[model samples]
Each structure stands twice: as structure tokens, then as C-alpha cells.
Target: MFSKDVVRYHHGHDHDHDHCHEHTHTRGAEVENKDEKTLKILLLHWVNHNETHEEGFREWVEKAREIGKEETASHIEKAIEYMQKANEMLIEAKKHM
Candidate 1:
């Protein structure tokens, strides 16, 4: 039988566990990392934001093509590709959310 379950067995090994923190400091800036609940919301927001930008980028690509600006279209496509990478990252980050 294949049991897909998460059973927590604490054998006094507390040093090898993953947990999310509420805040983080970077470059002397105190940033609110937020807890799991907030993270889920933020992840969903980023997913929407990235998707919107991706669509806008594609539209720009089409506009560039319409004007026979092959170079601009190519650059916009590259930007779309980069936006896709960011989308992938945001999707993966949902694991923590």
C-alpha cells in the first residue's frame, strides 16, 4: 500500500526542520516577510500581476510587429520570456504559501 501522508515524528531532532519567519532584514532594511497566511495571499497577487504583465508584453510584441519593427518585437519577446521565468518562480513560491 502506498500511503501518501505527512506524519510528524519528533525524535528530539529539532535542528532539521523548515519553518517560515515573519520578518527579515536586508541591507539594514527591516522587511515584513509575513507569515504563511499572508504569503498565500501575496503569492496569488504576484501570480496575477506577473500574468497581467506577460499579456501586456505580448501585446507590445504584436504592436512592434505591426509597425514592421522586427528588432523591437524581438526585444519585447525576450522580455516576455523573462516575465515567464518570473512567473515560474512565483508559482514555485506558492509551495510556501
Candidate 2:
């Protein structure tokens, strides 16, 4: 569960008003140009975290193979494929920076 403070901070919520998008708020910006640098940093962090998860999934795949659980291994392989696609999408997004 997300706390009120987290909601206020991340969603740019103002207690004076009853509203929150909870995602993609630009409350901190005071100029025409949005903060691309911060967004890039966030994307890089996401990529790093996804890579870590991929490593864990790889371990699970190896363990499944060792235990002769091909079905489980195949599922992890599909997850890894999705992860790779996500990483590729992020890489494509970086090109805009």
C-alpha cells in the first residue's frame, strides 16, 4: 500500500485540491522544457532493475532444468523474452534523449 506522503510526493498532489494523476506529473517543472535528464535516469534505473530480475530468472531456469522441469523452464524463457523486449523498448526510448 502507498502512503499519503508517497502519493503527495510522486503524484504532485495538493491537499488544497482533491486530485492526483499518480503518474507522469510535472509539478516540479517551472519551464517549457520538461526534465528529460531525470526521466533518462529513471529509465536507466528501470533497465538496471530489470536486468537484476532477468538474472534471477536465469537462475530459476537453470534450477528448473536441473530438476527436469522443462515446463517451468519454458515459462521462464518466455518471461526472459518479454524482459528482453522491454529492455529493447527502453533502448529505443533512450534514442530520443
Candidate 3:
């Protein structure tokens, strides 16, 4: 008789191994990285502060465009791009922190 039921294992899956890998790190060493620490703080700050900044930036850009201020709109657009990059970096830093 052919068994209709089948089991599948995906990446990082170990059928025979019932336990997960354990990671160890030195105390204070991980947290002492200035860049990483700064990133974590920035991430948290952004999570709270980004909403206002993003909304204002969007509104300003839209208004600028509506008024046919192409130069100002372009500048605001560039600033938005930079803020996006900064936000992304903070996110990545949080992952490491």
C-alpha cells in the first residue's frame, strides 16, 4: 500500500536533530560596539519619531509640487531619499544590536 501522507523539511530543518543550535556571546562585549549601540538607539527613536517627519516631508513635497516649485520639490524628494536610507541603516543596526 502506498502511503498518501508525506513529510517535508525545509531549509535549516534537521529531522533527526530535535534540538536547536545554542549561541553564546561574551557579556558586555556585544553591547560595547559604539556603532551598533548607536544604531539600536536610532532604530528605536525612528520607530517613534518617523511618523511625524515622514508625514511632514510628504506634505511639504506634495505642496511644493502642487505650486509648481520643481526645484524645491526635487530638494525635498532628495531629503526623503536620504531619510529612507538612514531609516534602513537603523533597521539593519537593530538586527545586529
lDDT of each: 0.67, 0.71, 0.63
lDDT of 1 by residue, 23-86 (tens): 4556332344344555776577667766776887888889989999999999989988888888
Candidate 2 on 27-55: residue-level lDDT in tens?
65533234564567557766776787799
Looking at model 1, the pairs that clash are: none
* Model 1 RMSD, rounded to 1 decimal: 15.7
TM-score of 1: 0.59
Single out the weakest 10-residue window by summed lDDT for candidate 2: 13-22
TM-score of 3: 0.54
lDDT of 3 by residue, 50-89 (tens): 5557778889998999999989989988888888888787
TM-score of each candidate structure, all chains considered together: 0.59, 0.63, 0.54
Model with the higher lDDT, candidate 1 or 2: 2
Highest TM-score model number: 2
Candidates 1 and 3, the one with greater TM-score: 1
Give the candidate number with the greatest lDDT: 2
For every candidate structure, what is the RMSD over all alpha carbons to the true structure, in angstroms? 15.7, 9.2, 14.9
